[model samples]
Target: MKEQTLPIIDTDVHHSPDKKEVLAHMPKALAARGLALPGGNGFGNPHGVNRRDATPPGGGEACSDPAYTLEHHFVPNQIRYGILHPAGLLAAGVSADYRYAAALCSAYNDYMLESWLSFDPRYVGAILVAPNWPEAAAREIRRLGGRPEFREIIMTSASESPLGREQYWPIYEAACEMGLPVAVHPGAEGNGISNRPYAGMPSSYFEWHTSLSQNYMGQIASLAIEGVFNQFPELKFVAIEGGIAWLPHLLWRLDKNWKALRELTPWLTEPPSELIRRHVRLTTQPIEEPEKPEHLLQIFDMIHAEETLMFSSDYPHWDGDDPRFVLPRKLDEAARKRIFYDNAAELYGLPPQESTVSEEAANSATPTN
Candidate 1:
């Protein structure tokens, strides 16, 4: 029997927008000043971060040209939908000037809506919010959240404090009101005004990248223990580009600690792990490769992956995963379908694809030996 093709909803497709274009949308005073977004940690990738071949034929940065990206990435990969997370401005959430950060975010969103999301129906937008200014971020969410193209709210994982703090609650409130999930992507860690890793800053991009998941672990634990989910039951969060191997371990430790110290927080009526399972979803990219592939599958089961894991290509980045070979072949078709399409479709409230519906029906009707 020929293998069936599954629909893909890539949750982390990145596009690098030109700064001038983004600035064009900003207030004339800021645009005239030519302010740039905050820079990343000095630990640089000596060989660079983007794939060489991903550059557009028209001579722009990789993933910068919407048409080229659609032709090269979406068509070739058979991606039914690609969530656009603008690359360069992800660090705006960490800027010291909260007002400036908020303005930059608004400009970037306008640029994205005009340049990328409008270029194709397949492209979906994630509303960029400045976490430092919760009110401003909330305003931005309220401004753009009702749009059909915009499906999720995004902020950088790098921050002065854990995301669950009361300061960030307004953003969550707006997201819930808009029926959108909040997503945290790592790009500003140890950069600008954001706090460094708990273990202190790493010396190289390699070291920094390896420890990226630490921020996610901290954020997820904070959200659960602080009762963020309890306050906004409708809110959902996507931790983009953070590897999944650490999830099972983090939840295990969280559950054990909660059991021993239930008195510390009276509001938590259930285990931290249960709260995390219900509110958090993660993308699979830069997926952990254990010595035995089966070990990865075991991790998936521990985390209830079918309900929590979503597929992300992190496209055009040097370390991006190819949907074709990212998952283990041993994964059953049902699980594969959920990760590849269903989980994201449900999370983003995307309509069911006709192809996917027909494919499911065909599979169910086939006779088995």
Candidate 2:
């Protein structure tokens, strides 16, 4: 956010653990059953899962090693803090055996703690819990949620039922009690436990990928209509890997619908959009780049970008946006600082050293032509 490089707090960097790595931590019985990452239940992903370029030079997959990730992302990019999202293995959200699901999630969290969080001061984790088993998930959250290394609780965005349903309340309760935000990421689609993209399964990966925002839209609406914000006033939710452009449209539709249907959800005493503004935040990745760059700024303004949006590189993934170039080059300083650093800093409870930016430097920087 400064004329000089500002420290970035990336909210949606992904870490894809190999099956063997995770299974090595699980019980033999569980390991024998076998597991694959979240991109598919069994069906092959028609499209590749990550960028070839993102694979570490040392080679495994993108995000396989803390050392490789540091060399590739944090050290070179001037990132002060990164929230590690391990969404790939969260297919546990679809596991039939709640015990197995719980075990897998717990083991994965342990692996993340030892392998990533403990290994690096700059990196923090989102405790992945299987929402399919709310009680066990809550236990998992309570178990690991208090650790300084884990700043949030994460679950698959595409779940068997809309996340706002009463059954998921336990998980939300645990996050709120621990004072950690809930980050729902879009992946693991069509995996029995999670819904496929809207209007039944799409025929192609492209269609499936493009419709991810619809899933977030449904989740946001469900949470708002069901009074989740009212029920858990302290809860904060972040929609990860979902681009920010759709937010204004969603809020607009929600407000109009709520005015007409307020009687349907009396508990949502205020407008649905208002609740979303107060309680929800979104990550910027897979950003919806427009033909005209200036139009991007208008969308941000419409969505109150400073208050609601945060930047995420979605690192090691093909679509990862470079911090230097991802945002509009001529963005005003205040908007740039909040999107790149401050919003995520406050949301994730980052220390002042990582969260604070030099606003004077940003303000004084020469404007781009």
Candidate 3:
């Protein structure tokens, strides 16, 4: 690829790692308590360390090689999806053991702010945090907010407490104060968040993928049902890598539940959908596969949320699709401009356009007559 072939602000590129880069930052005392990462700890989640964990490479070896970076996967495909990644992938990639999932996550945010975001500010990040360890997570958020490039916080759905519980309040409060959105994508962690239910039902990748956002749905609904959202009005939550097709349904179910159970939570002042409509937005990537009939675009319109759908390319993943292929056929020019470009621009504080002109876009589209 050459200078022009940049991806659209792909909010889901997989790695920007530095193992020793972060392990070294921790004091010997803390480092000793934990093993470094990129090994067994982070096994098979979406952004698992190294493309294939069975064949793990050191941070330097992994990131130095094109196969492990966004450029290798995205550039050749002729897609203009700029990379976005959870800070945890970097932490796990940089450390040999998972001991410092939280710390390495912090270090990677620093590296990204100083490096990747500067690699081009249009480049954005989803800094990882462990909500189970709210104080630790809060510390990282405060540290990261100081940097302009580290725009949001990323966490696994696997928190120690259910998201609706008050225990996670610090995480919510810190995010609200920092003026950053929390990017919650469903993925794995040794303990932070888990998709597996270990129930009687047999599980498949599709099953887990569907449930990923369910975890958030639980949290958000709980937060609203339990009145957490009422207290933290400023919080803006972004769902990563998940398509929004299921959201309208989730909102409908939530609204129905509130009508049935509103009396249980005395503190809540407004309807559940109002909270959802105001504070949450979702990325429109891996967009439920086929872009269908014209009415598909109006699904959110029914819920009064046409503007909340942002776009993301789950970059570097084998299944991550090209933006040209993902964009809906009926998406108006304005919606296309936002989903393909502007929504993310506003979300991550990116400029209207970057210096790179998306050579991939230029090459892929035939010249207009």
Candidate 4:
């Protein structure tokens, strides 16, 4: 199949609500405080965040206009589904004032539902929740999780504590009850009131961006070693925009440590790698490109890419991937199909497209399990 002909489900397309619009959804008192969503730490991108061509013709933010995004991004790319992650609220989880953070997240969800989701059938959203206030976050999940357009719950990776602590169990429970996957997206690390990067602060954006994967490693290890999967078997955790290459090493180290320390985590009946394979999913953007293309393929195989990986454009961002050229051309067609569409479709409960029926049938006949 030609690259253009393949069905695509972009799992990390970003869209931001107009600040005035989001404020309107908030309680008047909270809105009056004039608190905006927390921006990232001081390291500035030398190049701007959005692609030069992404700005809407009407002169607004890159993805702030749904109609413009559909025409310029989804339709042109033939994306069957575009999972909207709010760019502005990516750091909301790290806000110092927990009540304001929760209120801001709730407001963002309302803005997405009314402004973006209703505007297009292809647009689905991740429910933004404040990590600091898990009970309030759970309430937000319960409030909007039933909406067909909201498929997952999202929070920033930057947090005062790792995500697997019991405080976050309330949010996970609500997501499980609503059958929504919980996702962590980067942008908040070393930002606002959240904890600084594990290696202290980086001196440049280049250093910081390269080190983003460290945050994912810590969170994934915490979630696995802390037995989050054991408590919530139905839960799926997505690490979005975090590169995939480090996963093999992380999983290997986790399994190695667990072997010696299994008694400490009795709830983890199986290896950490096994639990991660079952409960965690990752997106492909800023995918690591090794000098030898085959080396990247080896990493994919090591991590069981067919089951755990999904495609994401990170649309409108400066470093977003293009569906036509992101993965190596030499990758197997069946695996490409799974990465581009099948895996995400299954995770988000989207129906199979006629274009992919043949691949789906072949895959089902030889199930990965």
Candidate 5:
């Protein structure tokens, strides 16, 4: 019997809006207050932001041009639906002025709807909400959360404090009330705005990237300890671009400590590991590639990949994974179906859509990372 094919539903495709497009959405008054759009923000990324070759033929940054992106990724990869994780704009989460940050997020969402979602039915927008001001963020979610294109609330993973704090609970409450999942994608670390590592900033980019799991670990632990899962049982979180290998270690430590320290926090109704498995979902980009396939499989087993893992391409980034080969070869057809399509489809409540890309069209366009 022939193996079954699945329609790819990518959860973590990044798209940076053209500066002009973002500016068009920004109010002239707010634009003057340093609502820096996309590439205009002065923060330097030493390795540059995207894959150099991904620049659209129309003359803009990678993932900026929706038409080129469709030709390069969605068509070739047969991605029927994608969650647009807006790049660069998420730094608003750590902005100095809460009002300015909120405005920037609103502008970014408008830009996404105009420049990306309106262009294709396959694309969905993330409502960028600055968590620094929880009430404002909640207001934004209330305003736009009901839209069909704006399906999820996107916030930067890097923040002044752990996301589980009561101050941030309003954002999650709004998300739950609106019936959307909260996606916390990774961003720059050690930049003086985000939560810092226990040891302080790493000396090199390689060290910084390698230690990103620390950020996720800290946030997840905070959520568990603060009883976020207990407070909002229906809420779901998607952690994108953070590798999954550290999950097992974090879970093990959380359970071990909870057993001895259960009295300190009486709110936890279940083990932290169990809560994570039930409430959290992780993306598989920058997957923990081990020397041996067995080692990778071991990591998956420990984390219960089938229950939590979802497919993410991180498209147009230098380290983006391709849907065609991101999964380990050892995964059976059922696991592949769950990761690449079913998990995300169910999580986002996306309706099944027929594949519109023909084999000839998919083959005619070359694939880009």
Candidate 6:
């Protein structure tokens, strides 16, 4: 019998273009404000840098041209690396030109459907939406409903409205109705200006990247305690680009608070941890370093229950870990099967993998670390 090749899907893969590429289709009035147009360059992330010093073992030159790379090199590289479902760029914050932001976002989403995800049945995409305007976001969600290529809805973790608030419920409800997963991807410092936190982490970029996940954890935990998931049981949430080790800590703290405030928020029928177990999913990307494979297993064993962790490559980000190098080494065959492919395929509703990664499998099939 022939062995099954693991069909992997990377969920948190981000495809945000530098300002210039994002404004490519803005309107005349809005295009003028887009960086792609003349004299339109004001936004930049203050804390972002590619100190990677080099690419992940097998990752090629996707960084040089992500917008075009996904169309050519990206998917082929993912396929060669044993990854099948490569979700790229569709979820990026493309509304940089605020005036025509919605139009720009629609064009980008359409492009994802036609240009990238449409390029291959195995590739999936997350539709980018601005939480700042819930009504407009709802419209986009409705627009893309049931599109096979667009299975997840991606948005920034930071928003004008607290994620737990009712103002965002319409967008949440729309996604649930459509059976799409709502995913939060953390953006950089210029992604939004924060009065707090950034003040202390001035010197280190790692400080911000690590803290970014915690910020989303805080918001998602707040929503869980606030009964967001309870109200929308069909709605699945994904907290992406953060490592999974923090899950136990965040869940422990959330459970602790709920114990005291059960009366305050009666809608929470179960503990915060239970809610996460049910409707929430977290992505593994930009991993923290560990000394050995056992070291990683110990971490996942405590914080994530195999299926809870999804595969992600912060593709094209200078420091984005090569999926091939960062994933296969840390997990055993069963664990790798799910994190690297199974869970992601299930998340995006794609075809399943034929085999799992074994101890010696990395040498033969070349699983992403």
Best of the candidates, lDDT: 1
What TM-score, computed on C-alpha atoms, does each candidate reach? 0.94, 0.91, 0.76, 0.94, 0.91, 0.77
Off by over 4 Å in 6: 1-5, 16-24, 36-99, 189-204, 291-295, 328-330, 354-369
Question: Candidate 4 residues 252-312, lDDT tens each?
Answer: 9999998999999999888899999999999999899899999998988998899899999
User: Residue pairs in steric clash, candidate 4?
Assistant: none
Clash count, one per candidate: 0, 0, 21, 0, 0, 9
lDDT value, residue 350 of candidate 6: 65
Please give the lDDT score at residue 37 for candidate 3: 38
Model 2 misplacement above 4 A: 1-4, 36-47, 353-369
Error of 2 at 169 (Å): 0.4
Model 6 Cα lDDT, one tens digit per residue, 84-114: 2222332233334333546666666765564
Worst 10 residues of 2 by lDDT: 360-369
Tens digits of per-residue lDDT for model 3, 1-369: 223222355666665355455555666676565444332332244554344431225444333333334345444443343545643453242233334666666666665565556553334566677664677788788877766657778876554456768777888888888888877765552232333332422244545555555566666676677667788888887767666677778788877877877778767666778888887777766566534555555764654434677656565455555666665566566666666566766776666545444544334322211
**Residue clash pairs of candidate 5:** none
Off by over 4 Å in 3: 1-7, 32-83, 87-101, 189-206, 290-295, 298-300, 303-305, 353-369
Between prediction 1 and prediction 5, which has the larger TM-score?
1
Candidate 5: list runs displaced more than 4 Å. 1-5, 34-47, 353-369
lDDT per model vs. reference:
0.86, 0.80, 0.59, 0.85, 0.80, 0.61
Positional deviation of residue 122's Cα in model 6 after best superposition, in angstroms: 3.4
